[model samples]
Target: MKNEPLAYRMRPKTIDEVISQAHLVGPKAIIRRMVDTKRLSSMIFYGPPGIGKTSIAQAIAGSTQYKFRQLNAVTNTKKDMQLVVEEAKMSGQVILLLDEIHRLDKAKQDFLLPHLESGKIVLIGATTSNPYHAINPAIRSRTQIFELYPLEEDDIITALKRALADSENGLAEYNPEVSDEAIHHFAMASYGDVRSALNALELAVLSAEQNDDKRQVTLEDAKVCIQKNTFQHDKDGDQHYDVMSAFQKSIRGSDVDAALHYLARLIEAGDLPTIARRLLVISYEDIGLASPGAAARTLSAIEASERLGFPEARIPLSQAVIELCLSPKSNSAITAIDQALSDIRNGKAGLVPKHLKDGHYQGAKELGNAIGYKYPHNYENSYVEQQYLPDTLKNKQYYEPKLTSKSEQKFAEIYNNLKSNKK
Candidate 1:
């Protein structure tokens, strides 16, 4: 126990002690309610690393009288699980904290399903991957899924303060003097990872130069202990998708600063592909027709980003993001297309007009294809009125032009004029 890492040693002993994740372990939360009722059910907690998935599992185990067992889905074999089953048989019930439960093989899953159903083994599967996406549906269907968010800076600070004052399973015995700056550095630099913060604090305390028989941990010491600041930006994690969503929404909402902030986050994650793709989508989908020039510029920026690659690529990307955020927003184009698609999907489409059908085929003029097709280019002002849509949708209006920008205003003028001419 003395040799154990500070994070493991200081793991929350009960749900009350668990830091952050108030939504899960708070007094009025569902997990807390279940615990109070002593009617614990199988659950899977999914989130990014160091956000208390295992701590919550351990805390849940500590809150109950059930024999607790920990295993890794990948490292532990079916035989190891059999031993756990045997223990469950003798002990009546067991709270099994299966780490990386997403990786559980079919054999182990099959063996455990009956026990889970019998209430002999209450599973608390912990995984960093989204359970709905990574876990087998068979096991997933049997468990309630909960998401754990990254710890807040204040939460990390609270954990640090607790560790500093704790004599047992903590660094209180060292009598280390940690500055507020150092504490804040540990909290913020860890990026909501409590385990990383605690481990770094422990290292800073133990390795600091002794001052007046006490080790004084400075901000520099904290920085040295935690060599690199790691942000919670897994490209495949929930936070990544959330950031991407916020990025697009911020641009759509015309919040330039917020849009750039999310852009910077994506850039930091080195997700040029996602950033490039999302920006292109925003240009055409949200800003379409409102500022066609901006959409064209966005495409150019994406091309530049792809050619230049990151670091230098961020310049064009930043310009594009700012332009998009400040540009007039309109979803008219996407809305129009989607409305048209919905009509077609719902069987609103009828046979194409004979005049509109392909006349370049070998049928020649006898088939009557394009027999009366009016060529607009040969008419006055390159304008001609003819049946274009299918007969069923001849009067079906899809493109409702919004008077949001100068360009779209012109489009609306031309569209309304054509409608009047058709009448």
Candidate 2:
């Protein structure tokens, strides 16, 4: 037991024993009902790391009389899935727990699709990615998706207390006294990750024992332990949000140096590849034609990042960030879309004009749907004046394209033509 991993030995064996995730494990939860009635469905648990997804699955297996088979999708293949299915055929009731199911390729995922629909095996998938986007739609549609939130700070504190008090696997031998300040520090650094919190606690206690002077774990001890241990960077947590905010604001403010710094921070912090791609989208939608090349360069950076992971990828992300920051900024396009959405949401959405609704020019000219609309392509300059907006917003100037060398010329010509037509 001394050589065993702390994560393994501390695994909860019962639902009551499991920590956090009350929304799913509470008395009246759908999962609890299924376990009580022995009628569990194929379900997917979606959440960040160390949030008790595996614990919940194991508890469900223990509660029901089902035969449990576990596999990691990162390493398992179709062959392993086939083997599990074969065993399930002869079992009483089968619960197939697939960890990191999003890591499974489309082909392997498809293997379980038919089996899930036919109710041959109760499939339980655990994933860190958004199931709606990560899992194949066919597979996602077949399973009941349940989102598991990250562990709360209070829950992490509770878990730390339990670990300290429990004699079987806790710090009973060392008799280390843990301070409240130390606990608070651990909880904050854990970032809603239970496993990380527990690991930090175990390490801090172990370090205190080695020192021989004081057997008490202090706030300093916990901080030292955390700094020494591998810092697990969660891309969806606070750091992710903070860095992205900084990056976006830097670009908006046209601070190239600041933007590059934030970009480097995210790269070093292990942000997801897709997040970098999303920033590229903001560059185009917010900056638009002000700097035509900004969006294209950002896209190229995304592709490069995807192809070359990590250290190699950081270069492209830095390049994109700098380029976007230096580009002339404009948000008229974003403002236009946002205003339109707000109007729709506020119930002020007006109808499409009658003339635009039906082709009056092709048939009944007096029907009013398409009576006065002009075709822009049919004109000499391939531009025409038309009332594209609702009557109330007919003259509203939403998109004021920035006056820049790249876009000013084209917009000037178009604006003059449209203004003359309106007169």
Structural RMSD, model 1: 1.9
Model 2 lDDT-worst window of ten: 228-237
TM-score of every candidate: 0.94, 0.61
How many clashing residue pairs, candidate 2? 3
lDDT of 1 by residue, 286-394 (tens): 9999999988899999999999998999999999999999999889999999999999899888998888888897885788788898999999999999879887888
Instruction: Please report the candidate that would top lDDT against the real structure.
Output: 1
Candidate 2 clashing pairs?
354-369, 355-369, 355-370
lDDT of 2 by residue, 304-361 (tens): 8889988898778777777777777767667767887887788866667766776735
Of the candidates shown, which would achieve the greatest TM-score relative to the real structure? 1
Output the lDDT of residue 402, model 1. 82
